[model samples]
Target: MEKNVKQIVEQVIKDVEVKNPGQSEFHQTIEEVLTSLIPVLEKNPAYVDAKILDRLVEPERQIMFRVPWVDDKGEIQVNRGFRVQFNSAIGPYKGGLRFHPSVNLSIIKFLGFEQIFKNSLTGLPIGGGKGGSDFDPKGKSDNEIMKFCQSFMTELYRHIGPNVDVPAGDIGVGGREIGYLYGQYKRIRNANDQGVLTGKGLTYGGSLARTQATGFGIIYFVEEMLKEAGKTINGQTVVISGAGNVAIYAVKKAQELGAKVVAMCDSSGYIFDEDGIDLPLVQQIKEIERKRIKEYAVRKPSAKYFEGNKGIWTVKADVVIPCATQNEIDLNDAKIIVENGTFAVGEGANMPCTNEAEQYFLEKGILLAPSKAANAGGVATSALEMTQNSMRLSWSFEEVDEKLHGIMVNIFKNTRDAAKEYGFEGNYLVGANIAGFIKVADAMMAQGIV
Candidate 1:
């Protein structure tokens, strides 16, 4: 059975690689998930017989279009847009819309593929999908950003609905962008289907605490991990990458839990402050002013700024959370982190650690939180937002937060139990993959080959 599973996984991957040439990110994600499913296939031969893995890798729908809009300079700007509805076995497709220059089909597919397991672990009714464009919002005026979003949604709005696919904010997409997209969606549809979108402004139908859900959720999962190891986040020195919504809020929650976040970064550079990161200052620089992280050092003379983003991993800390992009931490960074006596790593971003880096952490018996389970808070809360939208009611901040915390705790338990049952205890990568895969696979099987 083990041999059969191995052959099956290899064959599927080989086929995928041939079909998806140059999509390294997508191939990496599929390899990671398939590697963890061997134990699962050994136990449940039905999944293999049904060729579920084959179906799982293929997206249900892939939409690619050109987004053309006028910039502040009155020039015609065009960008590539994509939406990969990876899976809808459990429920309607749901994910975020990222707007960055790095957004490509491979990146979108990778995110959408990860979203399948991540959404499954959330215990929400939401399925998996991801949409984004190579439209970089940085340095764009508000009017320009709004126009671009409007044009992007003009086509996207046709495929998504309250009961179909719901898109939210990610990376360059935020409240302002969501508002523009949602406005366009509403205008085109000629109806108030607020549930068609997740992240929205409060004046409309956005959920409270949704903005902070992913960051807060990462901390909650980390807390559960610490508890299992007879440790706590309290008094821990933490280093987090990215100064975006996820990193900022993760820093806030970690600090509230008695952890001092020493360093954070942007695309240009990183800032390290031994006195602990100033949350307000970071918010002002990254959120309000939309400036680089080096401005953080300028504001606080005590904080030191580094020119390179990768060097932030070299800082000595007990915990490291990569809220940045995929493969941000490679094997070298992983070794440096391990050598610095880092005890734990919680990935707040999807596939933040390379395969080698992840293996090194697991081999050293470090507590590693896989992104599928650890960073599921955002989508989980988005599902909650969907529920509220459908019922025409809103949940209080405390109520939504309480539910988010409970879901994160349950996700940890699910991953732990799955790992132990599969004889891979403490291997969260395998645990999360198997746990999330089982849910989606079961649902897919029940629905038949669709």
Candidate 2:
């Protein structure tokens, strides 16, 4: 980057930090993405002249609301809700609604900002936005959960529509939450607006294979990367963090691909089964029983459960997929994986690896699949769901799976080619950021300043 351009970019970043105080996650992502785009800014002064980065860093709209609901105990409960419509240059706002207690403006902004590029890479007509509440669904009763969802939707419905913004599930949000929220949306609008949300129950408007999209998509992206390296998933030892929907299905797909998944985890802890994780047992424990990962050890004596989420990175493996959450893997975790000779790390969770960890993987020459490109399966399929809803037709599981496979394969090739084009050959972090950014940038430029 030229000295003058560098100063300009630095000033923009400085302005962001000064304006959005205490938003560490948002600040981290902004620094990581804009720094990677320095080459692009240098090569094309139009983006700088138009102040693309300045406009991009600031969300088009940010909604914060207080959600008050009655619990099963007839007690009033309150939580904060947020919806960050980060960008919509190409299409409608597309992203997920998280329900974790950890959700905040910074986290939502980070996810939404990353979604701008992720959706662009899909080659689908969807932009980026995210919304959710800081309501933990862990121990809540079904009725209580429904009450919370209904109350959250009462305020959110005004800001969303099929062609405006569509939200899906993430973290503490899932089928049950989607169902409740969708029901409330229907009640408020007095009309069926199925496309207004994704991840709905199959009996409603949800697309087939929607549940498996992210996990399966991660493997599909990884498979292409491995093939480029003249390797395959077969006979590889895999350790995945998180035993949620993403991790469990990733285990299923990887096992089907002939890889031995040795470990999986939850917020509480992780379990290691060297002989290979029994997919059925894990599915039963997590999906059906909704139990902690520690139960895997008790049920299967061969496996061992270890407390703490970070320790999962220590176990040696050929591949490591972080399906847990943002910043799950830091520089130290990257060191452990690189030292252990783990060659590839695919992210199933959004921004699962910190900037330092991602840089370490790149420095070590590991085949790293960044989250925006790798985990785009979920949102891509959500777009498919939107299509199904619009057309009033449902495709079979096999059809959706095949289309998803094709999309993931294309994402890998696009990311790779973008890296080669920008003199950052094989650097997917840069490649993904650049590839995802260019499409949106062009669209934004065409649309003019909004």
Candidate 3:
């Protein structure tokens, strides 16, 4: 690290440590962003001099509150909610709200911090923010889940708007949560503000191809990458972790592009079907049934459900998409994937690969696409959704899909150019950081220091 960077990092760490008191997740998020921006600092000394790096590292605003709701059994339930509006230098704060048992201030901050760069990488007119709750919607009745989302959004709606902050779905916060939350926002605001949200049902002003954008976008970028690598998804065996919307969609698109998806896992475990997963069956079990991956195995007797944490990364395949959670694939797992002849790794989840795991791939000359660039399709299409809402028009699926494809392609081009410009050769991680930070940093400077 450069002397100035080390000093800046130390100062920020000291301030965060004093305020957070042993919050490792927040530290990790800040560290990752700061570490990746060294080249940016070298390229643009003004950013470091203005302390823009420090300010960028810290969020502009963070909202935390207690969400109390009634369960199906009529018991009082309380879960924490948070919205970290990390940065808005480029545009309005835009990101997603996730609801899961693991959500917390630290986690949400990390996510928002990451989104600052991720949204920037899309080259769209949007900034970055993230929010959610520790409320687990799993096994909860629809009514119970609706009640929780209502409670969470009642506080959140006041802090967000179409032009201020636009949040979509993530992880546990899927269509159900978005629907409940949007309903609450509409009720409270008493206006037909469809622009206030994204990820809506297509019949209700949502864009077509929105559901398939992220997954398809991943494959599109990977396709461009495969061409560069002298390979293709056609006839390639793949192992994708996480059976959530992102993972499921990635599987469908990868298969559509002629790859064979052999595995998908949930929190419970992984299900491996050598016959290639039935997308419809996987959808029914996950989207409709909200069940575990192991259930997919029972339905197919020949399949195996490794009922533990380490089920993925152990599988041998040509490509591995870690769509699960942060740090789900570490150095050991990366070594396993590399040893298993895995040539490509695309992150569908934010920060899914640990630094060590990423290093393993970089050292081995493996093709790597970070989540910020790979999964940016969701947010890019989201910006299009916002435009449609503002214009009082809805585009057909083909229109939005074409626009999304163009944006993803452009994102790859920008990332590639950034890498080459920075002299890092094929380092997309550094490329993405530098490319993303420059736009936001320039905007922040133009807007004057706060």
Candidate 4:
């Protein structure tokens, strides 16, 4: 039986690889999830017989279009946009819209695929979908960004709605970008569908703490993990990658929990402060001024800035959190982190650690919190915003934050219980995969194959 299960897993992966050629990221994610499901498949032969894995690997619908907008120079700029409605068994499609130069079919599919399981883990009624464009917002004027967003939404508005498909923000997309997209969506649809989008400005229908949800959720989940292991965040030295929203708020929450966040990074480079990072100063530079992280070293003379971002992982610390983009931590980075005696790793970004790196961490007995479970705070809170929008009401910061914290705790418990049940006692990577997969798989099976 075990042999048959392993063969099925391998065969399915080979087929997916052939079909999804050149989509390395998508293939990587699929392989990781499938590898963890050997025990599940062995225990539940019905899933294999029904070909549920085959159906899950494929998206329900994939949309692609060209977005052409005018720049400030009176010239036209064209970019590609994509939306992969990966699954809808649980509910309508729900995910973020990323705006970066790296946006492509494979990346969108990978993100959407991950979202299916992540949303399932949240126990929210939202399904998984992701849409974005290769439109880089950096260095662009506000008017240029508005023009691009409007053009992007002119076509996207027809596909999404308050219930059909709701898009939030990710990567380069933030409150400002969400506002621009929502405005255009409203103009075209001629409806005040506040629930159609999330990450909105508070006055317009956004939820409080949505901005800090992901970061705070990471800390909350990590706290649960530490508690189960008879540990705590107090007095721990922490290093976080990416000075963006996720990283910034993770620093704040970790600090609030008595952890000293000594380092954080951006695309330009990393800043290391021996005396602990100044959260307010980081917010001023990254959020208010939108400047590079190197500015942090300039403002605080005691800190030093490195010329590259990857070096941030090599610094010695008790805890490591990668809140940056995908595949940021490779095997080499993993080796360095483990060598530095880091006791725990929490992924605040999607697939930040490659397969080999993740295995190494687990082998070293590092308490690993997978991204699907750790960084789910953002999407979970987005769902909360959707609820508020549906009810035509707003939640106070405390109200929303308390809900977010409870959700994170529940997610941690779910992941931990699933891991223990699957015989991978402390393997969160496997735990997260199995726990998230069971919910979606059961829903798909019950729905009778869409």
Q: List candidate 2 segments past 4 Å from native.
A: none
lDDT per residue as tens, model 2, 1-450: 488788988899899999999999999999998888888888889999999999999999999999999998889999999999999999999999999889999999999999999999999999999988899999999999999999999999999999999999999999999999999999999999999999999999999999999999999999998999999999999999999999988988999999999988898988999899998998899999998989999999989999998899999999999999999999998999999989999999999999999998998899998998999999999999999999999999999999999999999999999889889998888899999999999999999989
Q: Lowest-scoring 10 consecutive residues by lDDT in candidate 1?
A: 197-206
Cα error, candidate 3, residue 424 (Å): 0.9
Residue-by-residue lDDT tens digits, candidate 4, 1-450: 999889988999999999988999999999999989999999999999889899999999999999999998999999998999999989899999999999899999999999999999999999999999999999999999999999999999988998899999999999999999999998988889999999999989999999999999999999899999999999999999999999999999999999999999999899999999999999999999999999999989999999999999989999999999999999999999999999999999999999889998998899999999999999999999999999999989999999999999999999999999989998888998999999999999998968
What digit string (tens of lDDT, one per residue) describes model 1 on residues 111-215? 999999999999888889999999988888899999999999999998999899999889899999999999998899899999999888878999999999999
Residue 169 CA displacement from its true place in model 4, Å: 0.3
Models, CA RMSD each: 0.7, 0.8, 1.6, 0.7
Off by over 4 Å in 4: none
* lDDT, model 4: 0.94
Model 1, position 8, has a per-residue lDDT of: 92
Which regions of candidate 3 fall more than 4 Å away from where they truly are? 5-18
Relative to the unseen true structure, what is the C-alpha lDDT of residue 413 in candidate 3, on a scale of 0 to 100? 85
How many clashes in each structure? 0, 0, 0, 0
Q: lDDT, candidate 4, residue 421?
A: 96
